[model samples]
Target: MYEIIFNLHSFLAYIVLAILGIALINAILGLTGKKDFTLEKDFRISLFALILSHLQLLVGLVLYFVSARGFSAIQEFGMGGLTSAARLLAVEHPFINILALVFITIGWSKHKNLMEASRKFKTIAIFYGIGLLLILSRLPWSQWF
Candidate 1:
């Protein structure tokens, strides 16, 4: 079960990052070009990104609970006793990813409330962009690759 969930979470991370990056780029282009936020394209891309990210979050939460490198490490070693790699897995990565999701969710909500196309694009650009950056910052590059 742990291995299956771990693999799923790892695989889904790629999809989540790619879609989120595309959504961020699209938002930036829309904002810069002052393009109309079309339902067929802009809305769909943003919605897709949002959905995938939430799905990733759920998978990650399950992985965290079940994986030995996650909460179990913290329990076994205590917070201070953990090595840097252990700390990253047991603490930083999960916390930052959750924060990233919050930013993405806020962006989605704010974009909906705004009537202006530019404002909507800007909201998504800022929030999702930050979220993406946060996720990138804490990624365990050594383990991920």
Candidate 2:
């Protein structure tokens, strides 16, 4: 069960990052080009990225509770007893990822209430971009390799 959930979480992360990158790049391009936000493409892309990212978060949440390197690690080590790698896996990654999701959600909400194309693009660019950066910052790069 742990292996299945862990693999799902890891696999979904790649998809999430790809969609988020596409959405972020699209927003940046739209903002710079002063392009109109179209429902067919821009809206769908952002929505897809948001949904997929949330799904990844959910999977990660489950994995965190079940994996030995996650919540159980903290319980075993009592925080101060943890090494840097263990702390990253057990705490920092999950916490930062949740915060990133909040920023992404905020960006989605703010974009919906906007009337101007530029403002919408700008809102997503700044907020989702930050979210992306946060996710990247906390990723277990060494573990992946």
Q: Estimate each model's TM-score.
A: 0.98, 0.98
Put down candidate 2 lDDT per residue, 1-145, tens digits, no spaces.
9889988998899999999999999999999999999999999999999999899999999999988999899898799999999999999999999999999999999999999999999999999999999999999999788
lDDT of each: 0.95, 0.95
Q: How much is 129 displaced in model 2, in angstroms?
A: 0.1
Question: Clash pairs of candidate 2?
Answer: none
Best by lDDT: 2
lDDT for position 14 in model 2? 91
Give lDDT for model 2: 0.95
Question: What digit string (tens of lDDT, one per residue) describes model 1 on residues 9-91?
Answer: 99999999999999999999999999999999999999999999999999999999888899999899899999999999889
Deviation from native of the Cα of residue 97 in model 1, angstroms: 0.3
After superposition on all C-alphas, the RMSD of every candidate to the true structure, in Å, is 0.7, 0.6
Q: Judge candidate 1 at residue 144 and give its lDDT.
A: 71
